[model samples]
Target: MTEALRLPAEKIHAAELEALKADDKERRPPGWALSPRAAVTYLMGGKAANGMPISAKYVGDKRLIETAVATLATDRALLLLGVPGTAKSWVSEHLAAAVSGDSTMVIQCTAGTDENQVRYGWNYAQLLAHGPSRQALVPTPLFRAMEAGKLCRLEELTRMGSDVQDTLITVLSEKMMPIPELNESVYAVRGFNVIATANNRDKGVNELSSALKRRFNVVVLPLPDDMEQEIAIVTKRVGEMAQSLDLPAPKNVSEEVARVVAIFRELRGGATMDGKITLKTPSGTLSTAEAIAVMIGGLSQAAFFNGGKLSAEGLAPNMIGAIVKDPVQDKVVLEEYLETVLKKRPDYADYYHMLSDLT
Candidate 1:
């Protein structure tokens, strides 16, 4: 239980996945971790009949998780599109682990990624010295997953060059990749599939050719819609992190969590909760996930430096550190918000004073 945000998928709950398998009355393709329905449960959270705990990984919408799971269950591939911090890659990791038992099958799509990364690359020395053979072929994770009938994740899919991304078109629709140099082609097994995530902010972004899009059933993840849900996401994540890291337990904290989420939701939506105040928002995406991280960081600091009592003095500086992404305008915006919304709140004035002192 390191503090690192990304955990290897195999380290995820094995019992939960097993419960999913037992709950899976549906037919399964060979070598899958669970049936599609069970995969959805593990993603969205549900109980095992045996009373084992299945943690909720995705907190936004049950339907979206279902769509992604169903897409993979069918012959079609799955694509998750959203802004940063929306848990696109997290869901991808959990889904691959729950469905295929191997979350290591992955490719991090980037501007410089080439066909060698998505397909196969040659061992140049072996190619020149030993002639073309198995020893000269280095398979991409996708290629390995294809042969093994497992799920492969492509992160930041649109970030890759379109040509590099296009290699996936044949890999998905045709379920095969050709190696002319080797006079051979690799065809995927029955349960093989892809789970990809792309940034919606990156839309109009190197647009995935429609041909490529056709290969996937697209699921657009959304930011948490209301303040309470956002708070819940932040609170839950912070609590989990505290326990895993052995940080002194956070208390008197939900109020701060609520305030952080409320501020983020109001600013991101350009309006107040009662729809009374219309405020200007900055360019940074104030997502619930970020709020959770900020709280966890602040709490950890308080635990080590102070007496582990989560105080306004401990958290406000960190919140300011997280929100004021742009130095000039964002600073002004945050200052104004503090003066108007948080200045007069009865129990939260201490946080206001702390924030004023910091920023």
Candidate 2:
């Protein structure tokens, strides 16, 4: 298997859900592998009664996970609102997998997304020959999802043009897509649903219409709350990412990774871990996902440079490089964090030393 062909999500183990379903004692909805509670557990990571473990997918809020799972049970669509790296797409994938046993139905929304792309499109060459036959129609993921009554994901929904986003209104509320050219129409089957992810940081984006907004059950995913949770998330993600990339297993970087994630979470929350100090965050959101990438990059650096042991020597410099994207402002913010919070910590002498070596 060549490295470039692999995706991290492919390495993400989903058999855990299947196992839970096999042993599930709860009531399951029609076409659902596990009940809503079991699906939530699969996403949020929980201990089963039989000691079967489910890996956490989203790594954000528990309530948000519940709300997402709940929305799928109802007629309303689901909207996962958050900044980048909130695992909005990950949650959507797992929900689809547990609900329908498939996650391939998706329309990746972008600035260029248009109506025909969402609803249906004609094979232009076939259209020129056949001229508006059903054979010429190109069914999008949204179309198939409606026909089969499965979850269809719309990623980066806010990046889509306002007009393109509105293409969802009728399909959502009316649950019907009409094709005037073919003189045909299709109604959604039972269990049909949509999951859309939007970033809050993309302010002034092509905003959704009130009519469309009414159709979705919106749940905002938040950053990890504290050090332990953040570390746990980064550790799991980095391990999974390393395996997926076919990179050698990273070792002994947990404290460094923990330190980096702690910094990001602190800056994100506008306060120190102890809540004793407050600091201004930079423009960068410093998502948990990014922290995993940072550590993986650092590990790669260590492996390539120093025989695969992650020395403080290689880790600190790359850690600084990852966090300090904006030299002037982020540098000042980082220096402040080091001076006030990190420098005085008795337990983390090397962490403070790493920060000091940068200056």
Q: Model 1: clashing residue pairs?
A: none
Off by over 4 Å in 2: 1-4, 7-14, 23-26, 46-52, 274-277, 338-359
Per-prediction TM-score: 0.93, 0.88
- Listed per candidate, the RMSD to the true structure in angstroms reads 2.3, 2.9
lDDT string, candidate 2, 1-359, tens digits: 65556433323455676677777888776666678898888777887657878777777677877878888988899998988887888788778887777788888888888898899998999999979988899999999998998888999898899888988898998999999998889898887889999988865578888888999889988877667888988888888777766667655768778767776788777798777888878767888778887788877887688788775566677667766878899888888888888778886667678767885
Best by lDDT: 1
Model 2 is weakest, by summed lDDT over 10 consecutive residues, at 3-12
Q: Which candidate is the best by TM-score?
A: 1
lDDT of 1 by residue, 1-359 (tens): 65766567657587788776776778776768787777877888888767787899889889888888878888899999888889998899998988888899999988888999999999999999998887899999999999999999999999888888888988998889898888999999878999999987754457889999988899998998767788888888888888888886756678778877776787788877888777888667877778888788778878888887787777777778777888899888888877887786777688788888878
Clashes of 1: 0
User: Which stretches in model 1 have alpha-carbon errors above 4 Å?
Assistant: 1-7, 202-204
**Model 2 lDDT on a 0 to 1 scale:** 0.80
Error of 1 at 342 (Å): 2.1
lDDT of each: 0.84, 0.80
